[model samples]
Target: MQYNQRTDFRSREYNGRLNMGVDMRQPQPQAGSVHNDGINRQPMPPRAPKKKMGKWSRTLFATLFVVGFSVFLAFFVLESATDLFGLNKEDKQLEIVIPEGINTFQLTGILKQNGIIKQPVTFQLYAWYRSLSMPNKKYRAGTYVVNTNYSYDEIIYKLKSGSTKDETVNITFYEGMTVKEIANLLEKNNVCDADDFLEVIDKGEFNYEFMQMLTKNELRFRRLEGYIFPNTHTFYIGENPTSVAKKFLTDFDKKITDELLERMKNINMTLDETLTLASIIQKECSSVEEMKKVSSVFHNRLASGSSLPKLQSDVTINYVEDNIKPFLKVNNQKMYDAYNTYVCEGLPAGPISNPGIEAIKAALYPENTNYMYFLTDKNGKYYYAQTFAQHQKNLAAAAKAGAGVHGTTTQQ
Candidate 1:
């Protein structure tokens, strides 16, 4: 091939071959320079320099990656820890029974089932951490009354200590006891002081609408007089006063169902009025059958345009006399107390006693009869009459049967 004017003929001979005898000082072609036919061509654009990394730069890159990864891992662990431990939830009093021979895994399940704890795994993890600190401390099996208000540490400590002082106390209230008497019974049982119980009954607020309505009436001797259901109750020994009242009121609410409320409404009576009549029937009657008769007599007197506008009940008068013997003679002069049904035109102001469900049902569904007079004698014999003359005859028969007249009264 013919060489161009600007071509270096010696450089062409060394192309694609090693030449040990080539001139060392020959001017080198710049990087990216273009050449064609050995003529002098335009120089190409200069390339960007390759960056060189030193020891310190490499170490900085490695440290940043490690720190970023560690921070991300720490944040993840914190989020998991929060969920595992029950934190920032509503507090409630929960009673749980932990059986004997149960492992930590099983105990965590029980606590979660009872709503005492939120997370099972978190509880286990916390328990594990605690066990590490106290190698000998372990949760004992028993009935545990735990409150959500307690912190995780407090709850864990309490479980480890095996405290059972929070056991429930049993309280029994008998039928026909007044609120005052009921308070005394609670005091005697060491459930609470009598005065404290009375204060709670008077001032404590209740959730039920029926109780809310009664709270408005200042004339009520006890706001929840007939509503404190007379039954056996088991409550935590140091239970709140409002909580104790709620237990009895809750039982009463269940007993006096919507069906019973509708019945009272059908008869054009309020709960207070119905309970008042039931209390009278409760005290006047000796048996359940007698209750129906007594309820009828009161219903007959309460009828529209009845000749006897007032219910001449001896038990109501006895209530005014503070339940004294010879109740008929205890109050010769008509008392001004509203509970004195003999003096009051209609039913008593409120319930004289906490009557049972039977009496309550009797008042709601009285025996339909024209009988306006009823008498229960000392021999437990019952006398019913439709007129004054028939009533006198029945009383004479009761006298012949060796039965004494105790609650005999004349209607005004």
Candidate 2:
């Protein structure tokens, strides 16, 4: 029965295979085919190679770039150099004022501001270079009439050469003249404008020792009334105001010798006070001898304290009337009080006139005497008196001698 069971199972398997007709074996591979883990797959396409540039094309491109850059650089340098030379500028006339003591940098700034030059740094460098070649050449301070089209060399030459023969004038300011009169004379001779000269007198910055000793007083008519030395000076036709002022101040600085300074110290008087007294003596006296005598009278009165305080000078009133009143907007009593010795005690607010050397010397070294008053006649003769009664007698005698009797009338 076991042999028959084994033979029956083999017979059943053969019968199932004949019924379905199925194949259980592996298939054969095809030619010209690749397999991935016994499976067929499609192949990928090939990639193309990259293109490269030629040598001649790259060389041409580089040459064009370099040429373009060179052209741009050339144009930039040419424009800057032209500006540095002050060429290619418009043909325009300009008037510029060069301040005193200005350095080269500040001078260039002024030129640039006035449209005379385009580049300040380049102009300064050019100036430095020119200075090395021409050591004597320098820029001057004054009013200049310059053309905008001028080259840097031409401008420098014009400034350094100074004024021409026709451009200079010799003007004389007489002694004892007021600042206003001096201003008028300067304007008439075309040295400078009167207002400009007056403005400089008030606000100009002078570096002299005497100028440094001055105090700022707003009530004074002209701050430098007596300081401007009277002299015959040659000046440019239209000089700078500050330069003109410096000319006068420089002369004053020289005139005040060391001996005079020591004398001022010995007298216990300031430069301002000495100048003020000198101005009064200058106007009141007719001759140098008379100046000393009149100075003694004033000095005597000043030493008497409150007994004879007021100077009572008639010239101060004349100054107020002629110079100050005409220029005032309204009647100012305080202004009159400031300069009129009749109203205020001690010296007038400032010097009434510019004193000459003689008058200044007279004020410093007055004739030692007991004189307290002085009077002048029409003949320019002076008479001195010690007491009020004697002064009245001299005044009467002066009046009897002629109709015109002038001078101080002070009381003890």
TM-score of 2: 0.63
lDDT of 1 by residue, 149-185 (tens): 5445446656765654566678788777888888777
- lDDT, each prediction: 0.73, 0.81
lDDT of 2: 0.81
> TM-score for each prediction?
0.58, 0.63
lDDT of 2 at 379: 88
Model 1: lDDT to the true structure:
0.73
Q: What range of 10 consecutive residues in model 1 has the weakest lDDT sum?
A: 323-332
lDDT of 2 by residue, 272-341 (tens): 8899999988888768877888888888878889988888888888889988899778888887899999
For residue 253, give model 2's deviation from the true position in Å: 0.5
